[model samples]
Target: MKKILFSLFLLGCSASFAHAHMFWVNVFESDAHQPPHAMVSMGWGHTLPMDDILTDPNSARIGVEKLELYDPALKKTDLIKIKSKITEAEVTNEHFDIFPADLAAQKIALKKDSLPGVYQIGAISKATCYTHYIDNKGRYRIKHKSKDELDNIKEIKGSLKNQSFAKAYITLGKWTNPKPLGHKLEIIPLTDLSNVHVGDMVGVKVLFYGEPQSTSLKNNIYITAGSNTFGLDEGFNLQSFLVEGKAQFRVQSKGQWIINTMKGEDVTKDGKLKDLYGKVDTVYHTASLTFNVK
Candidate 1:
């Protein structure tokens, strides 16, 4: 087995990191074989590769609801049955104020006879609801329940439901155009993954519920990306607003890269939220994609 090393960095106190968390998937080529198989891992936090541990307020592990891999021929392999190796590590660097974290990872072997093309791996997280309000005692409290289920609250600060979707591409022998696997929110790459090089303009499209997200000042999609070597430095990475559901960025360097975006909707008055979870304020939808550039 090949060892995976993670470097921990101090998370910047930005507005995005102050209140938001992201989930993404990382695909690594295994070093244990000649034609390396793919190794999949889940990342949760603001930074790339690794950051804060994934857990609820009660310390319960938060895991993906679905994990699947698609072959070049579109054959699906369910990876939910594979037992993941969960590991934990404590961040004790005095230079950086951080907390302990956990990682869930697994290795998967690809089909030897599969077609030589791009393979896709995707994951979806279970939806969870949280409510922030002031209790009758004049104290602020955050509960992992809908406002309708909480009692004795003096003021309802906010409430929201969050879920995430992630996808990564790996090329075996040759490059092939990959199709979206029907994620609620997905990032589809218009540029070839296997042949991406520095100075190449890469294009991508953002889709919501299988429809293109039209560009608008109030609802335009925001896309961000960073290289594994540089890390995710606020205001220093690639940031762009999608135009008519499409965005493009120039490759700056050669290395592994991750691109991600998020969309939040005010669904407090929506009929769907009223029927599913009463008194919900917002619904957050996030998506990410990882690939390597030469």
Candidate 2:
């Protein structure tokens, strides 16, 4: 029995490590006739720009909990409500067929006749919990629940609650630097995103809970960046440790690019499990920022 439990623990670790998927938001200009509108879609998987479509079942596990748009003047709009009012005709795109038949994308209209500047779109995903354990039947099991909520479990291997935030910038007429949206885990661009070009160094700052993430030798945070052209080619990507919560990457190619980072903390160490959900052993916070380079 002890040997079986050890094997189950190893299996749990492997499963957790395999689930390194990232979520990001993609923005595209609408058709020529559909003025003042942009088509927004969610990207999920290990690739940039677009990857696996968010099917209904997987979407329920890690779907957008809230979506919002900020105009150039910093006027906030609840995109969820706007998406319901607008029809598919209002924001039709020639590339709409590229998405799956059951695509969960949205069409958002910009402020009518508003000044031309950078607009920000952000999405926050619902928190999801995964628990790995051995059941009373001596079978290893992974369930979307916390260890504390499981029944008839012989041994608990691990549990994690994950939440992700995705952000993208859309330039209408003129380009402007975007301000941080105050996500729990956020990536803020320090360089001008609109003027980015190949071979240019783009700098960004990572903040956790509105504070810069520490980069001490003992607690270094690393950020990874990839381009749509590479598509899951890790060797072609860039990874660097943050210094004072800031890092920079040189543009290797021109296309859609995504920068993302994740941080995990033990909930039990801080009594967060007892004080908060009481269902997770650890919690992970992930953030991604997507942009286009000329």
Best by TM-score: 1
TM-score: model 2 vs. ground truth: 0.79
Output the lDDT of residue 138, model 2: 88
lDDT of 1 at 112: 65
Decoy 1 TM-score against native: 0.80
Off by over 4 Å in 2: 1-19, 30-36, 55-60, 81-103, 231-236, 269-278
lDDT of 1 at 75: 93
lDDT of 1 by residue, 1-294 (tens): 000100011021111322245677878775477556887777776566776556533322345788888988889987742232343334546585444444447776766675788888888887767677778998776666778899999998767666789898778887777888999889999988777888898889999899888656678467877775554645346777787788988888877777877777666445555564466777777788887777
Q: Name the weakest run of 10 consecutive residues (lDDT summed) in model 1.
A: 1-10
Off by over 4 Å in 1: 1-19, 30-32, 56-62, 80-102, 234-236, 268-277
lDDT of each: 0.70, 0.71
User: Residue 45 of model 2: what lDDT?
Assistant: 69
RMSD in angstroms, all models?
6.8, 7.1
